[model samples]
Target: MSDIPLIHFLIVAAALFSIGLAIVVTKKNLIGILLGIELMLNAVNINLVAFSRHDPERLGGQLFALFVIVVAAAEITVALAIILRVYGQYGTVEPDKIDGLKH
Candidate 1:
């Protein structure tokens, strides 16, 4: 098999980021928005890993990616907890109808 090109990885990562952005912008459900955020985070991680391929040190990108992953995990936990509370209070997870915060 031929070695994968860096440009190919970059293009795929870009596509993923765009799709995630679209999902976040268009989705009306809280869970769907959360998933799109996760997908965008993953696309960032992919770009970091792919760039680390060129650098001999390779430490910077990998470290940044690790930080991103840890932050994403923390975000997911907190967001999920909030979403659960919202669901309990409102009986639905639609983002548009979550008007309790506006007051």
Candidate 2:
């Protein structure tokens, strides 16, 4: 069986992270930002899994990646709830237009 190189994994992770960052920066909608954040988290997970592949006994990197996934899931749930509430009150999801919270 042929094994893939570590560099390939690193390159893919970098690309995914860059795309996620770009989405976060360019998007104005709350959901779009959330999607970008998720993408970035997945990129991190990929890196973790890739590294963990080298040392199968420790499984540290894979464990950390699992933790990250759980946290990200919780974060998205809370974030979506907040976004819904904001949309309910303001009738829009654009962050810039929702200035009621500004103090």
Could you report the Cα RMSD, in angstroms, for every candidate shown? 2.0, 1.6
lDDT for each residue of candidate 2 in 1-103, tens digit (9 for 90 to 100): 6799999999999999999999999999999999999999999999999999988898999999999999999999999999999998899999999987642
> Tens digit of lDDT per residue, candidate 1, span 1-103?
5778899989999999999999999999999999999999999999998898768475788889999999999999999999998998888999778777632
Total clashing pairs for each candidate:
0, 0
lDDT of each: 0.91, 0.96
Q: Provide the lowest-lDDT 10-residue window in model 2.
A: 94-103
Alpha-carbon TM-score of each model against the true structure: 0.91, 0.95
The TM-score between candidate 1 and the true structure equals 0.91
- Model 1 per-residue lDDT at 34: 93
